[model samples]
Target chain A: MTQLAADIASTFTAEGAEPFTVDATLEAGDEETLVILGPSGSGKTLLLETVAGFHGHDGTVTVNGTDIADRAPERRDFGFVFQDYALFPHMTVRDNVRYGAQYCENPRDAEGLLAELGVAHLADRTPPTLSGGEKQRVALARALAVRPDVLLLDEPLAALDVPTRQSLRDDLVDVLADVTSIYVTHNRTTARAIADRIIVMAQGQVVQRGTPDAVFERPESPIVANFTGSNVIELASTPAVRSLLDGDTPGRGDAHGNGTAERVAIRPEAVRLDDDNGDLRATVRRVVREDATHRVTLAFDEVTVESFTDSPPEVGTDVVITLPRDRLHPC
Target chain B: MATETGSGLDVKTGRVQTAVLVAGFVGVQLLAFVAAYATGRPTWYAYFMIGSAAVTAYLLDGSSFVVATATLGSVLLIALGLPLFMFVARQTPSLVVEKAADPDVHRVLYLGIYGPLLAAILSLAFGVPLAHLLSEGFSGQPLVESLVDLPLVVPHSVAGILVLFGFGEGGAFPSISVLGSMVGMVLAMAFVAAPYAVNATREAFEAIDHRLEYASRIHGANRWETFRRVTGPLAVRGMITGGVLAWARAVSEFGAVAVVAYSVSFFYPFAGGEVTAQHAPVFVYNTYLQGGLQESGAVAFLLLAVSAMIFLIVRYLTDDNTIGGVP
Candidate 1:
């Protein structure tokens, strides 16, 4: 097990466009999975690639406290699983897994890894013939065979079908339990399932960092709340919502505001329908049925709050909902 | 636009319109053929003119624009192909058989084939790396890609002049006399044909996902090793297709090869002597200028048959569906 630390700053300049800069620092303990969560073009992949030594940057990356910023990708001993799997189309699954093992001093057994990843039956097939999930599994086996000091996965299951993605995501968690891994994805579900620690990135900066519960339940900024799928409500006109947000100061005031609390985020599960006396009155705008939960969108004049229930009320029905006192996170 | 009411009169009118259109198209082609013949052009020229007129008529037809345009486009391809068909049709089978047996014709044909083959091989060795770099967008990528297009746009005669000035005796490297030598012929052919190989290889390299190369690097392979294992094997089909196209272009080169090495004579110890530098096209032109149509047509027909056969073989070998593992 090896700890990894990186402080990276990168500038991307496209032709005829202003240059954009990305700056962030990350630290992961041995055997810890750190998930960098961000939308596309938020520099999550760029940060991961820079740490993998694919690009030069103003940064210091250390493995176990040894500077590795200037090292070549091969010398850095990092295994990268790409979004598209990037399996060699010319080689069979077995050979692709065997490829990286040849370069390792103490390589893992390629066949055993393939079997563990449940791709042993596809060993004789080339990448073009395999399904998306199979290709991803083979690519993971190939990367793991090298026994890298750090593993980097860039949206590893982003290209698969929904069912396949869910199954592979579960397998990924089991396989990477003991590996020092950095997984970057825009999907919060993936991050929540795999990350021991989550770094929320926005506009090329790390806006928030904490354990999954802290970040998801107590995001520090509006952008973090929005990205993490929390229901954000403005506190300007909704005094009733403001009163609901009473003691918990989890939300921060907007700098653009006149030195007062501006907005607050509450998880959808925290908003509960109350038949008895409730704190806030609202009109049900719409009801959406999901797998096991029905999401009810309630409108309070111009503000909207979403709440989930086992059975949703009819649309256009006047309802009273209560926001949990402890769960109103202001941002 | 006309509305269709599913009436008998509407159906009758549509049939009359179609008949009139077909008749007008035939009349235009007939007029063009008459004009070509009256101008004392070759029979094949008359056929080409009529083919062009028919294609133009289809292009100008107002009914079903998509179908008309597609038909006109395919017919225009036939218009370009008419001359080759005419040349093969005019040569008697007996004359082709006799020329095919002639050793002198075979020698010229072999020289034309082998020179281009050698040049294409050399170009592939050097062009693959250049194309890979350009596709990867190394610094100055735009400038380098634009420079590679020079041979494609330049006149074949200018390509010959440039080769002569660069590699000919007393130009730059005086010791290397490109005049009347195999090396000179190959160089001239390569100068004109290398761009095809480079462009095709570049396109192939571009088609590959860059993440594959990144994955290779992350797997502990160095830059060169990644290229050899991942990029090179993935792009091999495109490289080979480019090589074949370059070889065909080189074989057809007359202006450059002729200017550099007009006629190469080989003297053997047992036999008397042989001339090999007369490439197929050059040999046909010279025979036409010296002997007449009969001798030139025989050699032309033989060369055309052999070239077509080789082209088909190469195309079959490099077909995309058969190439390794690509879906």
Candidate 2:
């Protein structure tokens, strides 16, 4: 299996504006989906386009050890699905699929691919007449028809309803099962669902990169922890959370040798409610129902902690809660 | 049941009223024509025709404002068209047919048609690429725009002087005999009309999405291939429409062509002594000056007919809604 590697440094200069510089290195293994997660203006799309040979960069990009820095976009054989789908408005669905296939040395069956993408009925319809989801399906089918070496998707499901996004996300996993792909998105839920590995970007640089569980559970940086939505509590400010760093707590103290870390994060689900055997007692400030679970915001001295449980205690009720030592992550 | 019958009778009465109105209109037109003929004033006949057309249009449409505007426009057209039509009508059929078949007339007509067509083609070839660059935020686009607009804003005769100074003998290229040549006539016409082609093509290119071209490049097409397949087809309609307008303007141009090339005969060395290379409008003006109204009117009438035919054919081919059939 071949790997696609890129080490890029580029600058974007608009007239009468300050130049923005982007520097990052990325790698995607064969049959792996690597999701680039970032906020808007973080240069995620710029990085993808640069890797696809659509823009000039200072460093090198190679596939299977061959440098493709100077190659044209077509010669690079990278399939890009733009944010708006960018299907040729003048051509029918079948024609658009065939348009890409005609450029390939050994093309896939375009009609069969469209059928697999669940857009076979739309083969004769033009792009403007189709719904958003249908356009996305046709666009994906067209990109796949070329049998490209690397597939680049820029927010492929960003413009869709919740149900449609979920369905298509599932479909994408199945369709891209054997293809090397790089997906750029700002939505964390989408990143979690689509990525076998996640690269979190901030201000045009890669802040962190690891498996979704490792990054989400044990973020190495504050930006990563904040982006992953983990509950970050300052150990020096919150006495109740500070207790986890003490040697009295069983498994948590071993991970942090001297308890020198200032802040720690605990997953909301890891904060549990207990009656008799608990480390801390706090007053419930608010309770809200979320799907099948209850979210209780507990106020203890200067700190507020959120815990998920089967049934939430009423506001103003005093309860005993415990933060499992092993679940506490030092940041 | 009573209401339905009343409505049916109302519809029948409406039809009768329309029939009477149309009959009255025809009767009035006949009377006007007879009165103008009795007076022996063909101009009066033109006024009557224009007045009848306006009144009939108003009666059917029930809009006085529109009718008044239409009447004003029709009067202007009739003022120019009537004398030519009457002069053509007065000539013996054989004499008019003989004039049409004359080799001198054929030479002038050919130069008038083909020169402008060549100018339009040249404008498209150069203007399209410039328009594309300008649409992409070229820094000097405004300067180019203002330069193109110079010919349009200046008087046609001044435009002729400018072309002469730029291209004529004793000018920038002193050895070239551009004056009284076909090249001079083409240059003058193109200078006055190229703005239309540039502006229209620029707007068409701007209206296209840049992502369409980017997608084409990603689909394994080179830059030229992408333009040939995507950009060219999409912008062709606007280019054709602009070319037609430029050609029409060039064909009717007189002041500039007259100042630069009073006659195109310099380029036609083999033409007989009687033959001349006068543009259509220039030929008409010369005839009116030398041979009175009848001869000039016949030539003007022929030019108008040819211009009208070209306009209709181009308009039909470049109909907005049907171009490329995407919409």
Candidate 3:
């Protein structure tokens, strides 16, 4: 049996008179993961709440293709994870997980779910007593315990430290399998790693929409590219690289044969220093140690490219940097 | 070592000052206590002076001095007021009703049935006159002149005099007689003393957190339930404090009660209508005016003892940080 969780198409006005619209659909059956990626106050939360029936929403929303636009939140059959992990601070982990189930069908397997999420030991502890990662998992378990038709997670990892976020993100991916989920966050990396389909919003409207790779590779506009932390580079196409940039590349050209690329984005971690001569030539400008790896900055002509390296070249040193052919995404 | 020695001297001096202040306070209280026991007079005026010293001690966080003063004050109140209350209760009336058939007539009798009832009646009769006196504007006609008019005019030996001065005509007293009536006295008492209760209650309610109310509301409880569960319990102490203050004020009202009416005393079987002096304050005042100084002082002592008890009760009830919170 299949279920359609929510079909949201609505506009929202935020506190600063800024407005945005959301047009997204979630299918209930085979794990559909949709992530709403935008800066803060871009109406991601407003959109999520609209689906959860918390906002003043115009336009139709359907669950199983039936209009549930006027349904109450409790009756909407969607479980939401708040940014601050709005688990009832007073309730034990077990009670928090059981809260949603009390409103809907009794989730007979709540104990098993908690155990499966590795938070069974913390079941007797209050939300405040749990670590950030533990709290995030408990929130996830609570959301999923009711076997909701739709799951909404709003910045689930934002409250956690970086290492905790990574561990919880992996745990979330495995636990949310075979369930329709919509996540909202401003973090680009989380969205890129988790979203099956990303809806990039700005102000109050969806500015770009596609698979993570497509959207990151081919941002519909430059603003989306900048907001998503894509290095917008102007690449002057050479004869050899131009021949390689043909029908084989999905998004390689702008319409003119001048072979002038307006903006090309390559992930910082993807570009590497090659001993052989490569297409891009640059001087090592600065090396900033971030975590265990160094973030190396290289200057080529008027553009700078940043990359992660174990042994970064010294400042004022020249280097040949190669952008992997497949990783070179021209927007 | 030199700085440490200097600071040590400072501490010693501070301790000496505190000791001197404590000695002075004890000396005053001892004098007042001796005076009260010896003269058996209105001695609490001296106690009030000692109390003012105690107030300074309390504010300075001198717990030893405060405890000492409170202990002495408590003993004085119990010794004076308890006897007075018992005497008043014994003289007033018996509440027991004997039904030979039921054999359980005493069970039906409620607590403080006569005390509160007598207090209520006194408050009304005296309160109205007090209200009139306190409310009478800075004034053309004196309050006593209006009240004393009833004795001269009503049932006058000569009906011919009423025809002379227009006293029989719709006079102010006739239209709204503030003379020789219970209603006139009660209004007077309530007017002067209402601020005591109302101000106290309002402050008590103000001290509670409205956040707790908001938290309850968001947690799916309605307004009434929120108030009952959270606000009511939290403010219970304050409310009781305010009520006690109001009650004490109502008991002690006098000036207005005297102005409106002074004729009716509480009637008794053996004592045969002693006019119970209408209210406690008027009783004390009239006794002070008419009797020997010692008798007047005795009634004044009773009033002071009751007032001190009420003040102490209010202080205890309104203590802060008694409820749950991190320090």
Candidate 3 docking band: incorrect
Off by over 4 Å in 1: A15-18, A244-260, B1-63, B265-276
Best by TM-score: 1
Off by over 4 Å in 3: A1-29, A235-261, A323-327, B1-327
TM-score to native of every candidate shown = 0.87, 0.76, 0.54
- Please give, for residues B164-256, the per-residue lDDT of candidate 2 as tens digits: 989987788887778888778888889888888888888888888877777777778787877887777777877887788788889988899
Residue A271 lDDT (model 2)? 87
lDDT (10s digit) by residue, model 1, range A213-250: 99999887889988898988888768787666565444
The full ranking of all candidates by lDDT, starting with the best, is 1, 2, 3
Candidate 2 at residue B115, lDDT?
Answer: 80
lDDT of 2 by residue, A1-331 (tens): 6579999999988789788788999999998899999889888998998898877889999998999899988888878788889888778899888876667899889889988988899999999999889999988887888888888899999999989999999999887678889999999889988898989899889998999888888876678887887777776787766664575532334455654567777778888899869988889999999889998898886778788999788899999988887777777
lDDT of 3 by residue, A1-331 (tens): 2355555677754457655666655433447788889999777877777776666566766766788788666566666777776665545788767755544556636688888888789989877678888887887787777777777788899988988999888988876666778889999999988888888887667788889988886675667877777666664534334444555443535566334455567778778898777766689999999989999988877678788899888899899888777776666
- Cand. 3 Cα-lDDT: 0.61
- The parts of candidate 2 lying over 4 Å away from their true place are A15-17, A235-237, A244-260, A273-322, B1-113, B137-158, B170-177, B248-255, B265-275, B281-309, B325-327
